[model samples]
Target: MAVHVAAIDFGTTYSGYAFSVSAPETDLKDVEILSNQIWNSGTAEVASLKTPTCLLLSKDRKISAFGYEAEEQYADIVLDGDTEDYYFFHRFKMNLHNNKNITMTMVLEDVRGQPLPAIDVFSLSIKALKDHLKSTVEIKNIKLDDRKTKWVLTVPAIWTDTAKQFMRKSAEKAGIPRDRLTIALEPESASIYCQTFPSAGCRDIVEIESRYMVVDLGGGTIDVTVHEKIPNGTLKEVTKASGMVVAGLRLMMHLSNFSFAYLADHF
Candidate 1:
């Protein structure tokens, strides 16, 4: 049986999945990203390769929408002034990063100030993504089977053991078996992606044997890594992964607030 490689980036502000059918060693160019790329960014519609990491749940805790659909539906609910009943969560992945002692019993606060079990919040989000990913695999003529596929899940490198374990269990609850899933560090993955497609603009500075730094600014966390190119076109980390784990999201929020304030003052 042939095994296909699939990766799910359950990010803080967005989440999406991609699969590669070709062998990484032999056929490296047959990777495909999903075309379901349009999203409603609250004010306007936008196209993106990934969906917003937002989830809308009914009063009874059943998921009503996810990703872009969740964003639009939640916005409509807010406009209708009935936002108190529905639990809408956006950028909630940071909760794990903030808490060092995460557990199944820990409570998570939704955007509406309502609380739910952290496990329920994370697991439901993962399940939603996994189901959508399964549909995409079927569309690509690859039947879903745990044994015949390898799953790669991305997580921030600075997350604690408790946080990582929570994500692992959430994946298991989302129908991804322990044997088929592997957790990858987000910064390392980004480094690999960059190396796979080095920018022509920086080729002169990033030539063979050159050392460069990677500053990964994710939705919830920021990480920096220094890599040295090897003779075989591979990169090795020369410095320890370092950076503030909770800086990117906070910085983005501040920037957005500043932009709004600037517009308000001018108008």
Candidate 2:
């Protein structure tokens, strides 16, 4: 039996973790899910529930920083003319989706176009988040026993089995035991999260036989899924998850290009 349930949302643009203590006596509705503290981008006044999916590695192929701090340090490194000795990566999650020939030894290109093993990049990034979560829980006087904790990792539903396996391998390399880790679909996770709110004001809307559609507008793609609540208090997918490649990041790029064109014409 698990004593804690922790979930890591490893998103394309941002990432974060949340957890709840497992108690058989407590009703599911009463379980409190606590998320990590807000992350601030050191370069600006920006803050969010999740940090940027960025990472920096030293010349020796060791992780140097992650999230917003990674961005800040990479910028400083460039300004100092030491960029050749460092690697900066951001928005690399989509590589898994776009590449159909993913392999255990495939390499990922950094911001500088330098290549590094994909496993190293992913495993290090996950390790950073996992370590932070453990520290956060420890601060609350909770000792996380590896045997009693179940870890959940969310990925896009459209991902191929090869990609999912890659993630699992990366998680294992990051120190999460294979038996204790579970992979969850992003749309499904979102649907369940929505059920936690009160029905009168957005919670408890998902009752037995209730059916709904979940559209996830993520940084990498837009995914749609239909789910029905079963008598077993679990959700069943009515249709296969379908998604388009165009989503948040694509929209932003289009808007940025349009803005640039307009400025160039005016100036």
Candidate 3:
């Protein structure tokens, strides 16, 4: 019997999940990415399979919303002059990448400087994605069963053991069964997805045993990994992953500021 597999990419900038009824490895083309994945469904300002990793919480520390819904609800909260009574966080995943010494007591501050436990924020984010994924899977007429469903959660290849463990714990907290979960390196996941579809751009490349690099430019951090194609068509990490914690969103902010300054100086 074919098994179902789901992957939750808790990305720094965007978070989303993809599920396939049949095993991804059994038939590469069996994977079907869900459409209209998140909030602001028709707005041209925001269109994508995933939403920003932003989240909104109640004063009592409960998750009020997430993604574009979170953004919109937080804006409403601010307009009502209740920003202080709620927590709104955006692109906070970079905190883990930026802090090499992340501790249980470490806290993350919201846009209004409201503080909450980092683990709480992460678990809330993961929970949001997990709940949404379950809803979508059910909509596909597939009964959401842990026994039939296996999950792969991706993480940066260069993350420390502590960070990796934290993510595993967060996923467990989100209600994913420990036996159904697998921690996959981000680069390896990307490579596997790419390999599923044979591309003309890669047809001319040297055959098997070729080593290639995977460079991921995410919203919160950049990661690069080197992998070698093995005899079994599987990829093996050949070199240590390299990257930094600088936010990809920062580049857009800097460019926007520079453009505004130049326009003001000229006109």
Candidate 4:
């Protein structure tokens, strides 16, 4: 029997998935790279990549939307409300860890002035991604029954144990099995891909006896790590790493506000 493995990069602003097929004679040479592209626009000049997150609502007071479409639709509706009973937001991953002044509201009400919990919002997003995986691939429906499909989910290294537990719970609420899920640090995963580059001639080798910092400036956070290279070419952690979630996109938003204010005065 062949095995299907799925890897999910569950990012803050964007998320993605890659799958592999296990078969006989499936060595590194036999592995095929799958194209992740989903949409194209413009005069055959613009191509948009797909991300595994969305906002959606069903007719029966349920939300629905996923991937790039969900993201675009969420933005469109948030800025220009045309749809009723559907409220969505992208880049919600950052808000998951934030506890200060964060508020979320749903359209449906049950006589109480309360909206859905944050975990519910996250579950809806996960469901959209799960639906996409089912529709895009040719896996047997029995696979769903067998519950053999496993997932590797990525998270920022700076996340606390509490945050990590919440993410696990959210995934469970989205129908992903607890035993099938494995969590990996985002920067560490990126480093794995980065380490392959020196062998590919993409970057020159740097030989240093002392420890060095690996600073990852991502869309939602800034991660810093200090690693020591051993004599056998293996990397070891010399000190504890740190990160700040209030970087990257937040900084850009601040700059944009300044630019808009200056432009308004000039115009």
User: How many residue pairs clash in all the candidates, one count each?
Assistant: 0, 3, 0, 7
Give the total clashing residue pairs for model 4.
Answer: 7
lDDT of 4 by residue, 14-116 (tens): 6667665667557643554342436433333445555634455543537656666664554454445334446444456766555444333322221111245
The candidate with the higher lDDT, 1 or 4, is 1
- The Cα error of candidate 3 at residue 141, in Å, is 1.5
List lDDT for all candidates, in order. 0.77, 0.84, 0.75, 0.59
Indicate the residue-level lDDT of 105 in model 4.
33
Deviation of model 1 at 107, angstroms: 1.1
Which candidate wins on lDDT?
Answer: 2
When summed lDDT is taken over every stretch of 10 residues in candidate 1, the lowest stretch is 28-37
| Candidate 2 clash pair list | 197-203, 198-203, 199-203
- TM-score per candidate, in order? 0.81, 0.88, 0.85, 0.70
lDDT of 2 by residue, 64-180 (tens): 999999988876776667777888778788889889899999999775568999999999999889888898999998777755788999999989999999999999899898999
lDDT for model 4, on a 0 to 1 scale? 0.59
Best by TM-score: 2
Write one digit per residue (lDDT tens) for candidate 3, span 33-91: 55435556333476777887888888998889988888777656655666667887777
Candidate 3 backbone collisions, by pair: none
**After superposition, which runs of candidate 3 have C-alpha atoms over 4 Å from their true positions?**
23-25, 28-44, 204-206, 247-267
Measured with C-alpha atoms, the lDDT of residue 135 in candidate 3 is 86
CA-RMSD of model 1: 5.1
What digit string (tens of lDDT, one per residue) describes model 1 on residues 233-262?
A: 777789988877666577775565455334
